[model samples]
Target: MNLKLQQYINGKWVEANSGNTRTIINPFNQEVIASVPEGDESDAKAAIAAAREAFDNGEWASTPATERGAIVRKIAEFIERDKEELAHLESLDTGKTVEESRGDMDDIAGVFRYFAELADKDGGELIDSPVPNSISKVVREPVGVCGQITPWNYPLLQASWKLAPALATGNTLIIKPSEITPLTHIKVFELMEEAGVPAGVANLVLGAGDTIGAELSSNTDVDLISFTGGIVTGKKIMQAASVNVKKLALELGGKNPNVIFADADFDIAVDQALNGVFFHAGQICSAGTRLIVEESIHDKFVNALVERVKKFKLGSGFNEDTQMGPLISAEHLAKVEKYVEAGVQEGATVAVGGKRPEDPELQKGFFYLPTIFTDCTTDMSVVQDEGFGPIITVEKFRTEEEAVNLSNDSIYGLAGGVFTNDIAKAERCAAKMRMGTVWINEFNLYFPHAPWGGYKQSGIGRELGKLGMEEYTETKHIFQNLKPETLNWF
Candidate 1:
């Protein structure tokens, strides 16, 4: 694949002002795939200026809502047309299986199509007028320039979450995809441009968060900042976005919990538990890394998980039989290692995997064995911290109340799952869990129609659904007097 080696700024593909580049590596084999421009604050500033100018000039904001929707829908069509290529790029860049990347491409297209259909659904609402001979209505308008920062875990998928809504609502945006995994994002930008998006309406800046991302957050010209990443970086962005009091939407990583009751279908619960954390090698923001198992079945459940994990085929994402791929990079692998060591220090017993695999075939890549810690407490750092790896900390719970409490015992409340055969008990637990999304008898399932976000430090605003589109718009209460009957009182 021929990489687009420049940044998309101000309606033109251009190089970084400093003329520097960063090597794009395929994490599975540590091979350099391409070199992309290493953008800085200046490149971000230029992109922001372009977006602001385009918004102020009404280049995109003035377009009819249905027209914008059509263009956005076209982007979805383009994604479909190029889904296979996009999936290949995504797999190569992020080290996720090609099959998983194909699924993401499908979901990404669905997200764009969802927002496209929703774009013109609500022009505004007519309000009942309280005053005589008066007209009152509430209309939604574009929020001007927006800055979107997406994470590496699902590069194009996360970008679609931000881009489709922003564009559908007539807002201009500068999207900064994770520098490590930008291949699919760049390709999607090409698709958007081909879909008839005006040049400055959507911009792409490639670089690290400290430079390019900082400008997007701190710049006063930006009206909104939507970021998906770690809590530490999310907090820093919140502080920086206060410069102009820009509207913020954040999806910080979560140490999500998966509570399995003893009464749940034994085989299904065990299967879903592994499905929750092992997908993408547990790099997901909503990964079910914390397992709260009922005490009665704790030992049995751990044994089942260990057996299945032992048989997982670890290899290249392109391999059809590979169950899981390597982590994104060596640095991330080390972080997971450190987390495992810390878990051991905190008195958590490593039930299955506590170190990298000794397989010589996997040595060239960053591979860690699927790990499970048995004697984990809620207070253990392994349970509290978002390890973002292929590790699960199993904590025992005696009662339903104890399970709920243990699941909610975290600084992050993005998402969690409850596995049970009892419908009433499942509803009860779902209602009690303090999370943005709770799954019953399932895990890691999401769609474009439903809203996604968190309860606490996980995030500030919702994405997807109608609320996602609303995030890119501002409400205006327009009141007009039909008849001139004003009292001349000062």
Candidate 2:
């Protein structure tokens, strides 16, 4: 049986042009498990065309908001029904633990449910009119076709962040999942059609960023582009989308900060710090890789953290006991290794795990042990760059002012965390951090209704909450006559 994965386009599973295929390998076994139709710019353009037609003249856009929400709710129901099978495929493609994939499925389902309730609720307001006999009512309408590019870190979860709101607001979409992890998304679109999404409402393409991302951003027919990826790639997409002045929503990577105060709950802080960086092998864009700890407690925190990291299971993801999985690919693993070497060369001491695990069973997999580096400074590359791996850098600060200053030093202001028992101190630090999402007592705990995005180079616009749907819509004003006759003013 050839694990031939089909691309979902125009509500059908369409094969790519030339029929060239790409293999999907199991990262743990280094064995090919599936194959996908290798897509190109032409395929991407076709998806864009399909979405454009759907948003402009098809049934998807003209439908009422309440009806659209019903279709989205059905999509959610379909996903919940097939979640087990989808989660299994996602874990197979990305090398994440089955448990983590199940969690991602839960997030995906919740996103669609939230958007189902929110679609008709976010109605436009009626503005006060100053002119006589003139009444203006504001209207929010779809921005038309949206080109959404999702990363592989959490493929299904990221898609829901864009898909639910876009469809709910009557904006059609052409989504391009990272080719490295495209299986789960393939099945997702299969379910969308199964749930009765009209033809051309949602489409999928597979390819590297150069061919697919560039094509979608530059395509004049697309009204908006929503991307989630590294800052460099996000910048390139922004420049490309400027060709037609398309609306853009970028959820870029972060060099997030996690501050530990002397009065904090030490055990919880240590655990959060480890999880903030090492979970998913630290592949999360919002990884709290930079740790700013109070000088008085830095020593104790580092020791506890190092001990905790050592206990993490370093093996293949298929093993139920394994806690950490491999990096996305061999090249990424090498790049992460280079960063660790750079840290050691720059006078930072590796308090724990600077090299790949020596487990004979895990030799074939692209795995790295949970790593921690102490005596780090803001100027160092490890502190400045997003170490998108299981690596954490610890820096000590004498005062609250210094910690906040150092946390805000980087150009990234995506997300951050502050741990302090003192309410005043906690609020002070949280207010000073230049990020969009700030955690006071915890890190990475988020409600579905909260807005998420970044500041500065971290990217533009927001995702989730009401702001997310707004990103795919435009505002208009309507004037109605309540007076008997129009009064002419000179």
User: What are the per-residue Cα lDDT tens digits for candidate 2 across 1-490?
Assistant: 2223888788778788758888888777688978888899889988888888887795777788899899899888988898888888887877888888888888898999999998889678889988678788898988988999999888889999999999999988899999989988888787777778898889899888899889998999988999999888988988898899999999888999999999999988988888788878999988899999999988989999988888888766667898988888888889999999999898899999999889898888888888899989988899999878999999999998999998999999999999989999999888889999999888877666999999988989999998987898899989887775645875
**Candidate 1 residue-wise lDDT, 1-490, digit = tens:** 8757678887688999999999999988899999999999999999999898898898688898899999999999999999999999999998999999999999999999999999899968888998888989999999999999999989999999999999999999999999999888889888888899997899999999999999999999999999999999999999999989999999997999999999999999999999999999999999999999999999999999999999999999999999999999999999999999999998999988889889888898989999999888887899999999999999999998998999889989999999998999999999999999999999999999899999899999999999888898999999999897759898
TM-scores, one per candidate: 0.99, 0.97
**Model-by-model lDDT, in order?**
0.93, 0.88
- Estimate candidate 1's alpha-carbon lDDT, on a 0 to 1 scale: 0.93
TM-score result, candidate 2: 0.97
Off by over 4 Å in 2: 1-4, 482-490
- N/CA/C clash count, model 1: 0
